[model samples]
Target: MLKIGSGAGFSGDRLEPAEVLLEHAELDYLVLECLAERTIALAQKEKFHEPEKGFDPHLEVRVRRLLPLLSNQKTRLITNMGAANPEAAATKIVEIAKELNISCKVAAVTGDDVFQVIETNHLLPNDNPQQVKKENLLSANVYLGAEALLPALETEADIIVTGRAADPSLFLAPQIHHFQWSMHDYEKLGKGTVVGHLLECGAQVSGGYFADPGKKEAADLADIGFPFAEIEEDEVVIKKVEGTGGVINLQTVKEQLLYEVHDPANYFTPDVTADFSKVEVKETGENQVQVTGGKGHERPDKLKVSIGYHAGFIGEGEISYAGANAEARAALAGSILEKRLSDKVPHLRIDYIGMSSLHRTSFGEHTPYEVRVRAAGHSDSEEVAALIGKETEALYTNGPAGGGGARKKITESIGVLSNYLSRDQVHPKLIIRSTDNETI
Candidate 1:
């Protein structure tokens, strides 16, 4: 049986559960899907400040803990934690291994960055729902497929660090390495792709995000165990480390299966076009669910690129009102703030918490004792954006009764721009480094 587990769902996921998986699951490979569309963009911003600090902040911590287990040779690690600087991350991992007195190999995969291509080709945005400007682009990364991972695996590296890659490709690439599966074998590739999707979110398949009070509730969710997939040539069973919190049943598996999956019949990736239309999920045992019937087709010719650019500054403020007529006071405060900052800030959003904030609630139907009024605006001028929050805070003493806990913040916004590129356009680069803190 081939076993793989997810260590992270995002950049800031808890580290202990992943540590538990590394110590117990006896995994064949562990994938850390730490990069998101916005994550790499922010990393690029960091790169501007310092020459070698764009990788995941937790990279050193994770490597230090995993180095001991990695020396055992049965398990290897792969991650997209090297978000903006794979080579730098590789160097750091090797240095940590040296400090731990363990010998291992680290491979950094590169060439996913399409920043120069965006400038040279003047490529237009692809499927951009927001119609973001291509001219303001900061980071442009092509989502590399599983095939780009083949060379690094061939190097027999204990750890592989990548930049921006299709989430499933991180797990599928290792499967391709272990099974020695041909890229043309779409059926098994599709099955492997399903395995990747199920485990990528780390805790999502283990009931971390699932809870409906009485209708659905998982066990001991506080200590949610990271998820692992026990895969065979044809069958895949999802499970987690023993004696941990969270449940792994049909409900959890069903939710994770459809996550971020827009089309059930055609899910495109660089390696294969997976069809989850006929996939089946059934409980095989306690905290275990079996997956089957995933199909695939020819790979897509073009790969999707995620581009991030400056979207101006965002300033926000919030004030809470309590006691008598709190809901009414909160509404009045929002209206007043809007009127004050109306012309200064062209785009503003105001919402009353515990009232009709998220959606339309019955007006005065369920009077609440407390409500928070939040106002935010976006603009190119820092001063203009900051005025919205200042005016919101001014509502504390200027108008309304019982308005307290006023807080304000301003942040530079980095927005995402989606685009496509020809498969032939982006190329993959590989760099192998040894455990002695030396690059090869």
Candidate 2:
């Protein structure tokens, strides 16, 4: 049984669902994904709020809970939730395994965090000004692709974890570990990589984000299912845990096929080239897709990184009411707000949220009969609050757009922002690996 299991590195930072899978599936391979540029920014925000929080220190606790079960079953796990701190993540895992008397080897894939590495190595990307702006990055992570997994797979690891490797690599690493696949097996490797992508986002392929018109009876979304893979030499079967609820159908598979994936022909990752168009997904049973016919291409020399930048401070606030001509009045009211704020504090960058009349007022199809117009901004000066207050009152009267009553500001705080920076190249060293099968 080429059994595979999935763990979503979703925002809650909880692994309760994944732990449940380990107890039930007796999984041979576990894939976890936790890297998104947005995730990094969120981690940064958490760190900024509590400087000592450092990173996702809580994921380890969840993993520790599963260690005992994994110890009995000997199920190997791989995850990319080690955001911005793989070493720290591994250290915590090691500590847990040692205490539980469960022998496990932990491996980490580094070289993804290039924010500081670039400065030390003087490795920067193209000379484009915008690309160069990445030098000022608050965070830099190369969606490093698959190269990060090679070292860990080569070691004795029962549970391997990583951070910021591509979403699919979480799936590909297991293939590399089990088959000992070579980097150059473009065709077979590519097929394996494609299998990983299909299952990486558990719910996406299981009808959470997409639905099948032909298979209405196939859905059980209330308890949405998670994806799993049955691996073979050249193909994989996509299914979910037995008791879980959800549907995996053609439309759902098709939607996940193109989600954020640009250039299906050249879908790049460190592992193998995955050709989506060449892939065929057939509903083999309820909650199942027999995936095959995938082809891969040559891997790229340089890794692609996900970088983020501090655009500027942005906030939103508004007031709503039920009355006739509400949309128009809301628009006018928003304009009045900006005018008032600008008159009082001209230098402050002012914008009315719902008042797109300052721009294009396309309210889509069902325009709200009773809506709201809000204003917000970012200024390097102390006049920010004053501008907000001034605009709040302007909706009552005077200015280009006018409405009624008092306005509101959505209370929020924006601080040090981040961007991405890529290095031209680097000499990555060996980290450890997970030890499910060890040689003395």
- Specify the highest-lDDT model's number: 1
Q: Which tens-of-lDDT digit does each residue in 1-440 have in candidate 2? A: 56777766353533556766777776787776655565675565555576533345556666778778777778777777667766656766776777777778877666676666655654454443544344344565667555567677666677667767777877776786678777787887788777777777767777666645565544556666577788888667787778776677777787787887999877877666677778887888877788888788887666665555544433334555446666666656556666556654444433434444356555655455556555666543434654565556544555433354555553333223233343355434446633343222
- State every prediction's TM-score relative to the real structure: 0.96, 0.79
Colliding residue pairs in candidate 1: 126-419
Residue 43, model 1: lDDT of: 90
What C-alpha lDDT do the candidate models reach, one value each? 0.88, 0.64
Error of 1 at 276 (Å): 0.8
Candidate 1 Cα misplacement greater than 4 A, ranges: 126-135, 360-364
Q: Give residue 361's lDDT in candidate 1 (0 to 100).
A: 66
User: What lDDT, from 0 to 1, does candidate 2 have?
Assistant: 0.64
